[model samples]
Target: MFFTEMWERFSFYGLRPLLTLFMVAAVTQGGWGWDRSEVGAIVGIYASCVYLASLPGGWIADKLLGLRRAVLYGGALISLGHLTIGISGLVEHKLPFFLGLIFIVLGTGLLKPNISAMVGDLYPEGGARQDAGFSIFYMGINIGALIGQFITGFLGEKIGWHWGFSAAGIAMFLGLIQFWLMSPKTLANIGSEPSRHPDPAIQAKQQAQVKLFTGIGLALLALVVILVATGVLTINAPIVGTYLAYALIAIAFAYFAYLFIFGGLSTDEKKRVVVIAVLFIFAAIFWSAFEQTPTALNLFAYDFTDRMVGGFEIPATWFQIINSAFIILLAPVIAGFWTFLGRRNVNLSSPVKFAIGLGFAALSFLIMIFAANVVIGGGGIRVSPMWLITFYFFITLGELFISPVGLSSMTTLSPKRFVGQIMGIWFIASALGNLIGGLVAGNVDPEKLELMPKLFTTTTLFLGGAAVLLVILAVPIARMMKERKGADQPIDPTQEVPDLPKE
Candidate 1:
């Protein structure tokens, strides 16, 4: 399961780095010849759609198809989407490009949430096995990401964009096959038996979540299309960034209100939910900025950096590899560091980890700040590739500290019955952040950049402020997150993936 997932991610992320460049590249360069803002809009919208779709995907797994079918469907859609995109440029059709992007977005939405849910399903409730499994799975995520950079970045830049993209499509196709073959032998095969998602029971639950999420997503997309047609909104009004953020907040609140206020959760679980929601708000913000590496930051690499290295020019696509590479290298070390801390009787709570993570994030931007100075010479200068590498190093460290641990915490904290809904809410926070990240990128005034300092001072300042806020909340949130009688653990000890459908 892990390897299959990794392959799909490799395909997805491997293609990610090339997207902005593909959009803005000169027609002579086999691109659309769009401007930076135009490219940013496309990337942002694509990202927002992918994250936003997870809610319905997870709900479907919980209530209707179970984990296995959800994953199969998601993989098929993603494969189809990528294939479409691969052939999109063949005819030089802009609408084809947009349609291909939409397909990929929908496919991702269906796949991501359910896959992680399956991991949780594999684990027993609050068991050591589940914890270890998730960590290992996360490591696989980085591994796939690392390999993707080499394959996607290298192939996309060297052979043209479609080749890398087609490779991703092929990977998705294989992943679908791999999962199908493995299901009967895997825990997922056993867990998703008729007794687990009972035809009538889960089917009803899934119907509601799916109905709500799909209705909203489709409604928003319709508005976007209509407004764009009528000139009320640009093709990228909020760059998919703004709406994504808001949509997450909407999901979070709606679910929380429904579950706690009306749905009959215990007081302890409700309190935990409140606390988790606050934490999720921060998650949304953190990811929104960090996610820019592929969209806004990719543009930064293309326009700002000089790509020469020792008489050979580095492909701009290579920059995307840095984060994945950092994750691949650092994840094991970080996991070990946590274990070491645990053995030393010095466990850091999730909130403290978040603070520490935010602190680490400051390092990424600070590196970027210095890189800006590296270009300080009066004329055009590119920072050494090492700078971007180090920047990703910092970001990766922070992500390791917060992302998985926080996810584990949410599953641990949530009421068992609504785990799927809570996970969807958590994902919603990411949606918000991603949307904001796009908005920030879209609003970046390239001309005003000359009026300001070379360093991304505004962005840096915002991140710095967020880091400080996280630092302040570390202790309180930690205190609040302490387990209350441990009654909330899931059914199987394999809490690793929290039993959502396969993505």
Candidate 2:
């Protein structure tokens, strides 16, 4: 599971540093020369769809293909997707690029959740060993991220973007081969079969709904393709993207409402679900601020930060490594600190941790505000690279606080029957965050340099305001959580199932 996810993340992170840069670069430089707004819309839609697909992916694993087969099929599709992306270099056409992204989004939806599920299956009776396994797995993910960002980012910028993409493809294929060879022995019988409720009537109704929804989805896809072909619409057109973004937020709200009002949950369960919904909103806010690393922050590194050290100028993509490096170094420290605090009987509920996360995230942007000020104060002069490093350090700490805690809360708070659904909601919230974050990134202007400081300041306030709101509601949320759980419950020894391979 660890190695499989490591390589998957290697491919995913490998793409992150290059996507916007490739899109917005000039055609003369082997890019499509898209505008920042267009790039943002495209990236946001792509990212959002990747997470949204997880809902169906979980269903497929439970009702149809099973985890082992889903992982295998998903891995194959991912490899093929990267191959198509690499082919975009040869053809210089957008078709391959777009198709490649679609394949990857679908593949990831199938692979990501199932692999983590497999990790849980590794220890049927969970204990400290389960937590330790996940720690090892999480470490593998960061290691892959560091390598991907360092190697792929360098290759994409210094060599050719396609070469970097192809490297990621190769790495994924290698991981796939490793998994296939070893799984028969190591993961035998685990996640090998589907797990569905044994009720013919329920199964029949589910199948019907799946068919209906799938048909509608296909019809919508056809309509969009037709519109694009006829020049009636373009992918990621600003006005269209704005509507889509609003639609996503509405969908999130409506889904939660449906669950709350009509899902027939117990009173206590509904309260817990409400808590999940609140955390979902906060999670979206946190991700919106954190996920800027590869988009807005990457651009900042390229266009604003001074990278020269003595004589050699550092690669802008190399700056992407800082967050991953910090995660790798600091994750264990944070975990140990949490355990230390736990032993001391210091209660840090998820909401409080989330608030802390938001605060730290705001602090990161505040650091950027300082960096932006330095540039403006120096009359549009670039600032030191140390500014970006410090920014990453703060955000990584913020991530440590919020991301893991939120995942744990999702599992603990959810009724067992709806745990998968709640997990899907968590991913969707991240999708929403990435979409909004991309919109924020789209507002960044290289021409109007003075906006940099203002932009960072605005982000600072937004995230800080969210932190304040979470803090204000922390007591109530904690009370809700404690109502369902025992006051002196045994410590849960299992680590969180990761949302993505990254954290």
Candidate 3:
């Protein structure tokens, strides 16, 4: 499972590192010749849609075909999406480009939730082994991320963008193949079947529910395809068309959530839903700043930063590796720190973790501000490359605290039935974040170089402040959760579930 996930992530991040460049490149340079705004819109929309799809992805897994099928389908979609990118690279067909992106979005939606769920499924309940497995899995994710950045960044910038994208697609294919080949029933089980001791009538009802969700996933994918109609809506459609697609998806999300939140869930489940929504919103803010690496930050590395190293010019995309690299290096230290705190019985609660994440995010901006202040050169000015690396060090710490922990928290706190759906909402926050990041990136000054720090700082400060606010709010949220779930731990150890909540 770890190796399969690694290769999949390698493909995902590999393509991600080059996306903005691909969008900005000219037809001759193997790019789409898109303007900054268009690039922002496309990237923003594409990334956001990918994250948003998770809700549906979650539903398909938890309620529909179970974990196995969800991962398979999602993996297949991701593979196709990569293939679409490769096709676009060769043909430069505008509609194909959009089609490819749509595939990628839906593919991610399908794959992400199920795969992660499977990871947790490997362990029973709150055993320390579960924590260790997550740590290991996350390390694999970052390792894949680091390699993807290095390979894609170097190849896209120095070789060809198509090559990088093609490589990513190929990696996805390989991961898909491996997962298909290796089905470990017990190796790292994400979880067991939701319920098996049911009476025949109850079993039938469960099967019916699962079939309904499975149909919904298929229908949703089909609906998007129809709207896109590879035959009709080329990339030339009005921006409203894209907006409408998103709106429809949002409505679907609301509709499904309405069922689960109202009739399908307990009061505790609804509280967890609200908490997940808040966490997702905050996560959006984090991604808006951090996700910039691919788009806004990638451009910054290329256009603003001085890439000279002993008179050598580093490709702009190489800078993309910094965050992943930092993650690989920092995860253990952070995990150990968490363990140490846990031993002391200190609260490492979700809201507090998120708050620290926000604060750490703010501190990273301060680092950037200093880096910007000291930059050399007259026009845009260049800082020591170390500054970017330094900034990533802090930001990655913020990530370690928030991303994985938040994911675990969602699975932990959710009702077993709604785990996948809640995870989907979490990804939706990511989609919103990417969209928000693109919007923030849209404000980049093409003319002035010095303003880069200021732009980033403006955003970072907000994240930092939000983190503080969340930390303050965490006390209450955690308290609420504690009161509700004082002795009601997960009933099914295999479910990988967590708390009741008011957060």
lDDT of each prediction vs. the true structure?
Answer: 0.67, 0.77, 0.69
Per-residue alpha-carbon lDDT of model 2 for 62-152, expressed as tens digits? 6667778888888998999999998988987777787788888888888877776677668655445555666777778888888987888
Top lDDT: which candidate number? Answer: 2
Error of 2 at 459 (Å): 1.2
- Candidate 1 on 1-503: residue-level lDDT in tens? 79768877877777766777777778887777776666665576677667777776666666666667777788888888887887776876565566667777777766777777677777745556767777677766777776777777667777887887788778778888888788777663533631244476666665666678778877887677567656787644444445555666777778777877886877777767776776776676568668777876676676667787779767777787777677766766776776677677776655666666766776687777666654554344555677777878788887877687677876677676666656766777666665665555544334434522333566566667777887787656555545443565323111122111111
Order the numbered candidates by lDDT, best leading: 2, 3, 1
Question: Looking at model 1, which ten-residue stretch has the lowest summed lDDT?
Answer: 494-503
Q: Which scores better on lDDT, 2 or 3?
A: 2
Clashes of 1: 24
Candidate closer to the true structure by TM-score (higher is better), 1 or 3: 1
- Model 2 pairs in collision: none
| Candidate 1: residue 60 Cα off by (Å) | 1.5
Query: Candidate 1, residue 75: CA error in Å?
Result: 0.3
Each prediction's TM-score versus the true structure: 0.87, 0.92, 0.85
Which tens-of-lDDT digit does each residue in 1-503 have in candidate 3? 67767877888778764777787777787677777656766677777777778777776566555777777777888888888877876775665666777787777887887777777667756456666677677777777777877887787878888788878877878888888777764444443243342487777786687687667876876776677665554454226435744673475468447845574677676666666666766776787777766777677676667798787789877886788777766766776676677578665667777788888877877887666556524556665677777777788878877787677767666676666666677676667666655554544445655566677778777897888788788767766666566356433221221211000
Tell me the lDDT of model 2 at 361: 93
